[model samples]
Target: MDVDARLRELGLELPTPMTPAGNYVPAATVGDLVYLSGAGPLRPDGSMVVGKVGDGGLDLDAAREAARLTGLQLLAALRAEIGDLGRVRRVARIFGMVNCAPGFNRTPAVIDGCSDLMVEVLGDAGRGARSAVGMAELPFDIAVEIEAVVQVST
Candidate 1:
């Protein structure tokens, strides 16, 4: 299926790409590899979803949702850079970070939210190497953050 069709089938619409909060660009391409800057769960209105997994009333499910949102933001950046999701040959690597309370160790499960969405939207091309790590804290105290590398057709 085409990228737009797949997104419609999943009932998802890409948000506008966000401007970088700092000096870095949202995405940069080197040859066929596109590296996306770390993204957080920012709503369209620009408010962030903030919390720590396993603490302050947040839980696994919430963190997973946050990860999914971060993934969407990454996609938004990719689209902004390449202008066509169809040009993506494969998702290459993803690094996920989850802000967690002490003793929490379910980072992988949370990051699966992002991984599953990528596969759902792009099929096998979305499968990739990944790492999920826990963070004591994150910018904005967001529940999760993710960065991605994608291989695109030249």
Candidate 2:
């Protein structure tokens, strides 16, 4: 299915691409690989989902949702950089980081939120290698952050 159709079927709409909060660009391409910088769970309303996971902060469910939101942001960046999601050849790799309190161990499950969306949107092309780990803190204290490497048509 077309990416737009798939998004509609999933009841999702892409948010506008976010401007960089620092000096770095949001995405860059070299050869056929598009590297997306780390993105947090910033919503369209400009509010971010902020909290650590585990202990006295957000729970796993909330963190998972945040991961999903971060994935959406990555998609927005991808669309902005390439002009077409259809040009994507494969989601090559993803690196996920979760801001959490001590003893949190469900990083992979939380990051799955992003992985699931990619697969839903791009089918087999979205399946990719991934690493999810815990962080003491993240930018804005957002529950999750993710960066991706996507291979696209040259």
RMSD of 2: 0.9
Which lDDT tens digits does candidate 1 get at residues 1-154? 4898889888998988877889999999999999999999877677788988887657788888888888889998999999899999999999999998898998999999999999999999999999999999898788888999999999
| Candidate 1, run of 10 with poorest lDDT | 55-64
Candidate 1: misplaced stretches above 4 Å? none
Clashes of each: 0, 0
Clashing pairs in 1: none
Q: lDDT for each of the candidates?
A: 0.91, 0.93
Stretches of candidate 2 exceeding 4 Å from the true structure? none
lDDT tens readout by residue for model 2, 48-138 = 9999899878998888899999999999999999988988899999999999899999999999999998999999999999999999989
